[model samples]
Target: MSIDITANDFLMGGGIKAARFDTIGTTVGGPITTQPKVEQQKDLDTGELKFWNDGKPMMQMVVTVQTSLRDPEVPDDDGQRAFYIKANSLKAVREAVRRSGAKGLDIGGTLTLTYTGDGEQKARGKNPPKLYSATYQPPAQAAANEFLNGGQQPAAVPQQAAYAPPAAPQPPAPAPAAPTAPAAPWTPPPGMTPEQAAAVAALPPEQRAALGFA
Candidate 1:
């Protein structure tokens, strides 16, 4: 009698690393087969669970993608086939998926994430957050069949249109103010005494204007 074992039986779990988007234009992408999971946030320095001031642990959503994409700074033999995304970067991917009319991200589709630029600066002396853009390409019929056939060659498929986010709205320009007539030149009243006229002349132009002398 013989026993049959599939390749997945010998696969090890854990050790998957997150992808980096440290610079502008940096991109990473892969096919998403599973739904995103939520987990407790961990402290970067100590690898301990991070908690809020009220004693509750901070939570974060994780989306893992399987791909051959590798960071140039990492070693070739690292065998890093999967990467996870969370935090603000995850928001971008969620928005893209929503805009694509998909109910959720796990559509067995490819997800591309690009670091577009830096976001608005927060408190003074603190670094600005990184901004990202995402694109989701649904799996083609040929590609799905190729996977089911155990790595067989896939048939050619027509190109699908890429998604583009709408531009930000701008504030309308202000309207010009109406032109005003210049004030008439000031003169002393004809019935005033010479002393009174001299006194009025001694006052500042603004005071005379306020007193209806202008």
Candidate 2:
């Protein structure tokens, strides 16, 4: 834990406000094209690297390309290298963003750099470009909300009250009936005498239960 992190480390860590990486720095192998040759009259010829009478010095140059992450880990290889980043928004050209990605602004390209290194080193390619991925998936609904306004907070659902069957509808009130003229006083058969009538009338309810004659 006593290790100290340099500014380059933070930029390469790739999580925040300043610069972000689209590709990690890689060593693109090949030769560093030396500066073009300038011809000089040899020391009176003989025993010197020679060209024809008008042999302006010529040297063959080899080169390869690779991109690097912002604030990359310095490559251990040799030769001049250029880093490339996929544009996020054209607005990213802002100076703030440029500085963040300018960790190794030492070579040449859109931005020029002078690499003091002797040669290109051996390195490999990163699996994918950073622009190929995103940090998070914002919620779908949240995106819709954002479109409508600025942002949206999820809403809480209300608790529903328990349902009750409507009161079994009330029964209609009973209606009143018309009065009867008096059941004509029941009369026994004409042959029947008062004595007989009395005898029958005196009978107990149980004696004529079928007709309710009590």
Candidate 3:
């Protein structure tokens, strides 16, 4: 295994950071969107492309977006920031759009990205915590009006519907209870005399029950 540094190695060593925002709100101005590019790598020493452990080309689809920070107090790079969606989050965004009935995303159209985390991703500063989720916010008329009225903020984009998981199957309904049958009148045991049977029958139901006669 040979390793060598490229002339642009210094420029390629930076990490991606999440846009700092106070709330989950509409991004200012529509984004300059780009299609996901397939991930690739080259060996600095051999100048050969690398493949995955399975002998297949290691590839990834990334959706990169740049938008304004909603919160004025939130710090951004030159008043804006770029977000990267890859791996599972990328799949989630695509599924979300499909469920919303949109064929695809349009460049310069209003879109919003929101973040949620349980602190694990937040702890790693290399990448914005993988978006808990991403959404396509459609531009609204009122938002357009506000944008045209000298406001830097554009009209609010309406969020597409999120993907809903299918409901789990319910347990099969319980079987119907067996029907009850009427009890026959009690009869005297074998060889019992008429008087004996009458006396036995005259006893309280509890007493007769104790005698095993119903």
lDDT of 3 by residue, 65-164 (tens): 5544344554544433444444555565677566545565544334445545422455445444433455564322212222344334322334569998
Candidate 1 has what TM-score? 0.51
lDDT of 3: 0.47
- How many backbone clashes does every candidate have? 0, 11, 1
The Cα local distance difference test for each model comes to 0.60, 0.30, 0.47
In model 3, pairs of residues that clash are: 143-155
Give per-model CA RMSD: 31.7, 41.7, 30.2
Q: Which ten residues in a row have the lowest lDDT in candidate 1?
A: 1-10
- Models 1 onward score TM values of 0.51, 0.16, 0.36
lDDT of 1 by residue, 11-116 (tens): 3324566777778999887766455555666778798988989999776555556666665766763423443445567788778777766665553567778899
For candidate 2, lDDT tens digit of each residue in 106-208? 1111221221222233355523212221111112212222222423322233446999866659766658877877755434334434643454444443342
Instruction: Compare candidates 1 and 3 on lDDT and give the better one.
Output: 1
